[model samples]
Target: MEKKRYYNDNIGPIKENEVLALKKALELCNEIGDITQITLLIHTKGNTGYLERIFETRNLKDFFRGVKIDQNYPPLKIETVRTFNDDWQGKKIVVAFGLRSNELHKYDDYENVAGIIAHQWSEDSVKDWAQSWGAIDLKTETEIEKTALPDKVVQQAFIDLTNSINMTTGITHPMDEEQCKTYIRALKKYDYELNSKEIFSFLTTELNWESDNANDVIKLIDKVNSGGYFKGGAKTGLQHHIKRWKSK
Candidate 1:
């Protein structure tokens, strides 16, 4: 349950080649007043199940969200330069990093490209950033503060968390406490109903809980759905579960 470290030298040393590439990319952004295309050789953490969706979206906002970030941050348009990493045999992915090159500029709304790289290029940083964005370890079953944040931002956080879940490797970045609460609250507030599969998916993938732990969450949800005596009804089920888990 320890928080993952991002922006640290945890992904092995950044090779001289990668540093040079990063420098070149940064230089291009400075010259063009936008992101420019630069090639990078990335060492994979393991399976590459999530690369396609990440590239398709061109941003990690779906998996991680930030607030009050540097507005002048340069946006990036990324593509896979190659699938093979020369240094690691075939385990790494070669990616092309660039400024926003697409016609649609919707994905360009981010703090900056450097911040994005800190998350995308490194696993520890992704966890660290997630922590910064208000994710918590579900195992702890802690309370998630509403932060008086706007509803839209919380909703987006839920959506992004789901998107990341759909592409998780089961051990990379897990949801934080705030994210867990946001998702549960959103579920309760939804006009429609959610099936068991949907509920299970959220617990297993989104929260990255083991089967037993996920089942516990489902039971808590069932208790809430059945109209328990909690003050706010099912919306408070999460808190009850947290309290019980903590007591045990």
Candidate 2:
């Protein structure tokens, strides 16, 4: 008997404007005539609260056969790819979506996986990976509209991005001065204004830290600000570090 082969795609955190992307992916899976073999993967070190809300809002829970997300926080011990393969009952054809250069190599070691679907928004390196496997590129197959995220959603995205960085880098005490700067730099991308106090409240609530720990974190942030670390020129090399760590 031939083993069933699932198709995988890295959806990451589904934002409001990215709903079209999700719909297109599902449509592609349906076109394959085996929606049951389609698995949507999200990679994040932070909690899936926001994603859960999105799933609920869009009624997206029933559209896919499997939805896998990273469970461990900080230091990224168990990636979704390995966890998915561990639980997989058969072969898998990875359908990469906007995969970064460092993330292109994760599927190479998996024995059950033999193909890739280079979906839209995929990076050049990801496309190259699919090409090496003689896989199909769905780049021009789906036409997703470019929509701007709402101001409120943009602010939330900023917070989520900050929390993800904090969790991945293992910044427990005060959320690492450099990481905080990265968050600040990220704010420049959005029109929404977030003060330090607002950021502190959002992060503490998101992390669900103890009262004492939250106070300590705020104090450290204040100290870091006093030391002029928040006045950053460029985004820190934290993303570079994350890429290197993720590839490992």
Q: How do the predictions measure up, each by TM-score?
A: 0.22, 0.31
- Residue-level lDDT of model 1, residues 5-30, one tens digit each, is 11222233334423443444454445
lDDT of 2 by residue, 1-248 (tens): 12222222324444542344444444544444333343434454233333344466444433333444322211111124434553444444454444442354344434454343433342244433333223332334432221222245434544454556545333453445445445444443333343444444444334443333334435544655555344543465444433333344
Taken over the whole model, the C-alpha lDDT of each candidate is 0.34, 0.40
Cα-lDDT of candidate 2: 0.40
Model 1 residue runs over 4 Å out of place are 1-178, 201-208, 229-248
For residue 15, model 2's alpha carbon misses the true position, in angstroms, by: 5.4
Per-residue error for 55 in candidate 2, Å, reads 3.3
Candidate 2 residue pairs that clash: none
* Candidate 1: pairs in clash: 5-124, 6-125, 35-99, 135-176, 136-176, 136-177
Candidate 1 worst ten-residue window by lDDT:
99-108
Q: What does candidate 2 score on TM? A: 0.31
